[model samples]
Target: MSFCKSSRQQAILDAASELIATIDLEQRLLYLNPSARQLLVLPHDLDLEKERLTVKDLHAPAVYRKLDTEIFAGLLEGKGRWEGELEFRDSNDQPIPMQMTIILHTDEEGRPLWITGIGRDLRRRRRLETQRRLAKRAFDHAIEGLIVTDGRARIQHVNPAFVEITGYTAEEVVGKTPRLLRSDHHDQAFYDAMWQSIADKDRWQGEVWNRRKNGSVYLQWLTITCVRDVQGRIENYVSIFHDLSEMQAKEEEIQHLVHHDPLTGLGNRHLLSERLQHGIRQAKGQEEKLALLIVDLGHIQLINDSLGHTNCDRLIRMQSAKLKAKVQEADTLVRIGADEFALLVEDYSSLHDISQLANELKEVLQEEIDLTEHRVTLSPSIGVAFFPQDAETPDQLLINAQAALLEAKKAGRDTFRFFDQEMSQEARERLKLEQALRSAIKGGGLSLSFQPKVLLESGHVYGAEALLRWCHPELGPLSPGVFIPLAEESGLIVDIGSWVLRQTCKSLVSWREAGLSLPRIAVNISVQQLEQEEFPDWLEELLHEYDLDISLLELEITETGLMKNELKALMSLARLKERGFRIALDDFGTGYSSLSYLRKLPLSTLKIDRSFILDMGDDPVSLSIVKTIIQLAQNLSLDLVAEGVEDSCQAQQLFDMGCPHAQGYYFYKPLIEDDFIQLLAASSS
Candidate 1:
């Protein structure tokens, strides 16, 4: 009986050793009795002495995929135990499921010791055995649907988000292809492309319409990606999707805000440019024509000032509405800038169409807008340029339109001009001349000639009116008519004006030195100089520095300048006149102004513009207008000066008309100061 007991005990111990050696959990043996390496398939690189080894000795298990590294680390760092799920794989590539239990091994009295992990492989359990107790959690709680498929996009798994989004339950979706959910919004080519992406192991993200279980269609942002095996073969396709109708709407709203003007809801500068370029290409390809018409508000600034920005805005909005009404359905009309707008009229071959539209646009603005007790009217200035004739590019078209617009402004607003070949040549020459002018100012190539402003009764030279003359080194003496306007446009007029003022003062001092007794010299001030912010102070400084009597310096202003900026111009003239300087209104009667307004202005003289004088000998209307101007000047107690009096007939008309002073080509052409002084000597002698 004793011998039998000993043999039985040995057999029991042997069986226990075999179990310990064979059971697996992915750690070094560390002197385990047996079988751990065989079960875990521990690599040779793993040492028996190692305290820790990765579960990677096999494929990491599904449970390990869900393990939170942070939580496991926290447990191991402080509590001396970590419990988590770890997925694994065997040598044959079968997925291995695992539950890992890491516990602290301690000695007596609870002293800290080694960390020992005990693992249970659950490859046979499919993680459902644990889930029956724990229940579906993360996979079911996600907000966006998570859909999985085989390499062919056949349905494999669906989450609660997926079922909720698609209105399909897991039981209904598991085996059916994802195509069952397709809304048919996309063609077969789309799905073919998606499948090709899966086979290529790529990803695609875009909006797709999907039908619900009840056959209702809804848009969703779908992201489909392929999972590849080690050999780079497509193993699975995973798609995450969210509904996209609301998002797309918000995106479209942003795009509209970017491309359209909010106030008029017109295509803005950006959209205008884009359309113009497209139109250019179309025209070129079809051998067709397009016209760019630039419409400028002639009196927007004045309206904005008098009626306030509120009414101004309302006016512009109304104008835009009218513009939309006026343009063709296929054309694009844009309020491109404040006070500036544009229209792209395609297939235009003649000027009459553009001219008619220009007329209609202007007529639309003729309606009066009531502002409290007052009413104001506005008109437009239009500039037109035809494609292939004016320009080939959008930018060039814009410049051409601008050039024409400038001409309209010169034509006195409420007018239209077409781009002509002559305009381009003229612009180029003006640019060249402007450059030469700048150089002339710096190089002292500009000279001042003088003409006598005679007192008609005595024929005595009051003083020589300084006239601008440019002696282009190669081009000979260039007329101010050729380059003065160019100078004014380029903002070089201010410098030229300064030179004239200084030279006139120098000439007056020279006349005094020469012992020639003459009246005060008059200097022509352009509308720009009148608008100068520092005109009064500048005049004071110029006068005081010249140490000349203010009476000896006369400042002439145009009727347009005086009429347009009445109050400001009056203040400026008043300030100068207060200091004893003579103020003469140049080109009088050229502009229409209320007699009350004209009478209210402080004036020393009126220089009637040449237009009224050109036909004074034969035109009764012209003669009547001239006589009325002289009478008006007399009524205002202001002197009258008639310009462009080229003959005895006109001079006699002015004399008979009681015009007090006359200056013209007939009296003496504009001459140098020396020639003028000699003429004055002859007159005096």
Candidate 2:
């Protein structure tokens, strides 16, 4: 082109997208098209010849230096044209990058007339290239898998993440349908619904079960969208997904832990309530009966105290396993407490069937279990409550079952009891008694009665046993049998026992001041009292407070209490004996009576249990038991006292058996403080 010669050519040059300009050999701008003016940011109204603008004014300084040395040198050396990237500066002094072609036009004389340059602004092209690079990088590095497919559902491209998730390389999956990844867990109907939704909404997102190249199935959260053309026709499909297999597995594990006992792997109390409620509903619908049995592993606290809690847990697991093996598949066994379990029987025929099952379950636990260090037997007590009979609701059934369990334990363990209205009444009465006893202990409604312990050889009062007595204002007089157990269960025995000790010391000092002296006063102690780690120190402080000798008070502990936790009881008794206090094993022959443990105890005397003493007159077995006990005491070099000695005949038999001491109604009833003093004075006379 002759560089904007005619109006038509000038108009075409002005409208062109490329920069078109002409400069003479002296580098002065001769003519400039509108595109060149705008690219250089020069005034469009200015006449280039009049303004004296040159190529140097538009080219950056560094770019002008390159054109002066290399570009112009090449164009003048018969090269005629130079094409490369060059920089142009705008009015703001900002560099504009351009791709340019410079042409050297010559006249008829073979001399350079002018140089015409055609350039294209490269900023927009550079931006498009940068965006393409970033998009490719994101597709390769994203955590979620990405897939691109053609409108025929054939895979066209796959990201590195897709290869990692599906174990399929791009070469293997390209041009293949998504059907290769189907796990076959979903039917055609499921896929049809998914496709229908996508067709309607242009997108679908949900969980899908798919197979990996390794033949393993997994869950994935997937989102698929249809890529459409301007005419709204299907062009491509883009899918993004993430593996949800690990998350789903974690959720299931959390659910299992929430509903199961961690130790035994059995159902827990929460699961029990749910299953019980469900079982009740099913029973009502089927016109069937279901029994809820509460099985209490009796004396577990004793086992825990004797063999440590770790072994106790092992024993509990063993028991749970046994109970599980004995129940049917329809039944549910739940660990409701540390040492308690509940059995839900759903397929029982009648009460007799439930009773038989309860007995079988109890007997299963009764079998001797071999703990690592000790082989021990368990005595399990079961309480049965029927659905729609004993209780109508799960909560009430559980409560009544527990109440029946208590009755079973009270009836001497290794047995089962059916729930009855009377048992609930007794449970309420026992709760009332527990509350009343707590108040009595704090309000001084309790007292101590003394029964003289006489010497069978001399008929002289040597000591008296102090008994705990409670007289409620409204209940008149409550038996020690009824309220004492309540006190022990409610943990009130510790305070009550301490109060008795202090009052007995006061009584001893008072009797001394009244010119009457009993050699020693024996006071009953509960196992809970001896279990106190500070019991010995507390007793010493109480004795010192009264200014009484420790020898003047005898501590009587039951054999059953002593045997509960032999090791701890032994240590407690040893500390007391070392402090110059006498330790007597009361109610002997009624508990374990194992000589292996008995001989190791630091005992001062053995009191024959009243049952043996009372029955010895009529039953030869009872007499032999008492005699054997007396001989055992003699052999152990321990003194003996016969309890429940009611007549001269029983006394003579005890004395003949070489029992030197006796205490019962025959000599004196449990007397008040004043009556005891009178008896003490008479004995002294």
Candidate 3:
């Protein structure tokens, strides 16, 4: 064929030219299409060969260097053949960054004839590549686990953190939905809501349990966001989270510190107050009655001072454990003070039911506690105040129960008291006094005294009983007989009692240190204090802590006190005996069935009632009673002590009746702590 048929040649040329124009190449570039010329910039210097340029060049620097290489130069030697683009600086001398393709043509024998180059800017593609690299780096090192999914919820991407947290690498998770990480903790409603939120192009945040690499459970605080297209269709979902294990642990610790007693792990005042408030609201709503119990652990201080603080702590823990075991989930048990615990019976059916429950509690507390190689125990004195009947307010309810608790202490240890209308005024007064007592304790307003219990045969100062004497500013010198009963009633007896025990033990110890031939000092226990389940423990603790000789101490309990809680009192006395204590039966004849009861107790001494001793000389029957008491003690081989001897005759009469030990006014009235110390020194001298 000719070079081209006339018509076909023009058509082909026109078509070729149009194709170049469509790709945005200008007319000048298409016609000249020289590699060198295409890579050049618009002329800024004097024209070379009188040539003129129409447009600026667009080529990267690397492109220019490559095109100048020998390999590329040889490729274009014969005809003009070029491929790829080259660098060209603009008039400002800053090279334009661009990419282009070079074209080569051959006439015959594959020899190149003409070369053409085309270019396109590469800034957008480079920008996109840089961003991809950055995103990959971030995903690899992120602190939070990430999961990415398409609109169908099929997972597309999972970062390394996800594999670390979940034990699933991208290969295992890429095709799975987020359900793979779910712990199945949520129900249909939860998932429904989640899906609904995602469908609406919204976000979801909540707590969720997830699985770890080892198939263990983990808690996560997660956030999920749904990405949507311009048409409002779901595009993807992204979930990110950090493990909340440490945060959850901290939160639990905070909650425990707030709600539990540090000493016993029982609920404290803060927790008590919260539970009480909640209970009140619930009671009011349900038209129910709630019973409140104010429990004062009797004689805990004596044990604390005698045994040691460590032993005391152990005892307190034991008692709390016992109390917890007896209490139901609905019941709130609070160790509000050292020796005082409060129980709120929120689900009691009635007053009678509360009483029965209280009886059950008493029985449980009476159970012997085997501790530190000894069986120690004390009973619980429960004072109950019921809803609507005893109080209309929370504070009033607590007050009423406290008042009743005081009454129980006054009556005897280990007994429960219910609120009565007549106790309202007394309760208010008692409340005020208790507040004052609390202030006094904080302010250190308590004092101690000693009462000498003389050795009847020796007629000299021997051992003394340490007594608590409160030096009140507004109220005169408060006797153990006065404020102690009050203190015990108000559950303040624990601290007061603890202070007394410590003071007595310390004083007695100092006396021994001072070279005094002092006898053991006795501390009378209150009914409220004697009932503590930890009584024996505290006694052991105090003895060890103070490093006192337990045998040098005497603990006297009244028959009525013994009867109040026979099992608990017996256990405490048994524990004390095991610890080498001198336990005496005080006010022996006063109880109705003293003679019958005496034989069964773990007592070392029997002290006849003062009434019998006071009238022994006048009433022949009184003398007979004394003689009978002596014979009974002789039969049992127990030491005999006489109390309340007013004169020499009373002492002589008891002595004549063969009583072994006697203490009363005939020996000496009670002395202050300092005076008792001085007497012990003088007597030994």
Candidate 4:
């Protein structure tokens, strides 16, 4: 009958999922639930209706002792309840862990009657708790910043990376809004749009600028995801972000290299073209003037040859610095080539504004620059082309500016020129002439002529000046005045001048070999040739080749040529004089004629320019200049030669002025070699 009662109680307890049992004071089980049977893996053959069960039957001896000491001992003392984890053995002898909650059941007399206990299987909950701890570790230790916010968008927690990235401790940021990190780079509207996107799409990701605890701004790639509950209600917001400032800076650096010159850090050609086109469009819209200037450094290669490549590069950098410092911040400076740079100017008041800027650039280039041991100055030729006037496109503007630059160079260094239609025509003609001159120099279209210099007293030939003449196949008899400057400007003067010397020396040898007595012939040398480091040595070789007397060779360099590189000219002339070759200062009174130069130069004669001689009888000032030049030559003990004495009056005046020699059409026009030989023979007779 008692077993039946226990069976009824156990049947009622079967509804509970936990293991439930009733135990007597002796620790014998009076009733146990189906959950308890399954938890212990009891044999189906042992029926609770037939056999008795004890706690010692299920629990290990150690577990029983712990139960007796901590849980059951307290329950036996009439305590209300006792709860702890305990171990029990299953039928397979494997240990099962259970969380036990036991209550002391007693009669009205306050004596313990039985222990009512419930055991929950701890394995599943233990597995879940372990997983939770692992997830917490990952969240706290992640490298990317992590933030957890409540549904109200208030910060609840932050990862260690968040604290590190923001320089904010958890104490400072918890319960605060994300506004603490806002850099104010974005307005409320931006935030509103971002939130709206997140609300509609459940997530938003982009680059954001935020402030750190130290008030420094940084860029970061941020992603915010909305977490929802099972009912689709917002539960939390999780944000993950990483700093992107370094990567962004690297990208900007790469972009900068694409549009800037590597050497000078100025704009390159590609960027210049881009900016020019944009400038044009803007100017057209505003109805404003835009000026494009192409600046070419004249004789840059000459500087390079003289100063070496390293110093030349330093000179170029200095020029760039000057240009940048002088131009307005709005203007664009571009290094387009080795010796060529371009400028795009806007916000100008008028054409005069651009012109003034151009002049300023020229002035900047004129300043003396000291590079290491060398002191140098640059002469920049600037060409200006206007918008809607000279050209409408970038290409056309650049071409027009370059054409005008050629005109500026032709006008001489340290100048600026504006574009016009005439310059285009002139440029084309100049190119054709340059090509033809090159051909004439290479082919045998060039020859020499001898103009007699006569004694002013006897009217007899003393010596002749060798003149260069060219007869182009297409344009016959191009004069020396027209082609000589071209040769000098084109750098062909060195080669042409050398050839002239060789030819003159050969002529003298032939004359001597044929038994014809000839005076010393003078050859005009250009500034380019005079500045050659090897000129003195080259002249010695020529003198040895012909086995001619060095005293019979005279070299005439213009006063302007000597002043161009005074030291070089001084050294070269001194060397020539030491070797018995006579040197004449040509075109006297046409250049800077300092008494110091007259005293220092190794000159044998001073040749009066043709301009003074042509105007001597016509202009009183010219006559006075001639008289003064003769007196100056006399004082210096230098022989004087009056050029262009075309009339008897001019020759008589030159003779009265104490000039020793005169050369002009009045004596004889320049003659070919055969005619010159005949003249020489007659003069000898």
Task: State which candidate, 2 or 4, has the greater TM-score.
Answer: 2
Relative to the unseen true structure, what is the C-alpha lDDT of residue 676 in candidate 1, on a scale of 0 to 100?
78
Model 1 quality (TM-score): 0.50
lDDT per residue (tens digit) for residues 186-242 in model 3? 787988987787666579888888887678899998888888899988799888988
Error of 3 at 588 (Å): 0.6
Question: Which ten contiguous residues of candidate 4 have the minimum total lDDT?
Answer: 42-51
What is the alpha-carbon lDDT of model 2 when measured against the actual structure? 0.89
RMSD of each candidate relative to the true structure = 13.2, 12.2, 14.5, 18.3
Residues 83-138, candidate 1, lDDT per residue (tens digit)? 77655555466654557676655568665444455556665576576675464565
Ranking by lDDT: 2, 4, 1, 3
Ranking by TM-score: 2, 4, 1, 3
Candidate 1: worst-modelled 10 consecutive residues by lDDT? 17-26
Q: What lDDT would each prediction earn against the true structure?
A: 0.75, 0.89, 0.74, 0.87
Candidate 2: list runs displaced more than 4 Å. Answer: 1-144, 150-161, 183-193, 214-218, 226-236, 429-484, 490-560, 572-685
- Residue 66's lDDT within candidate 2 is 94
* Most lDDT-accurate candidate: 2
Tens digit of per-residue lDDT, candidate 4, span 1-685:
3568868765678777898988888888887777888788876355665687888888888888888787888877767798889888987889888898999998998888998889999889888999999989989888889999999989999999999999999999999998889997998988999999999999999989999999999999999999999999999999999988778899999879988888799999999999988998998899877888998876677677667788888888889998899888888999998888999988688888888889999998888889979888788899988888888888888888988998898788799999999987776777788889888878877899999999989998989999999998888999888888778877889999988999898899899888899687989988788687799888998889889778887889888877766766787788878877888888888886756778898889889999999988779998898899899999988888998989898898888879989999988899999999999898778
- In candidate 3, stretches whose alpha carbon ends up further than 4 angstroms from where it belongs are 1-422, 439-443, 526-548, 617-621
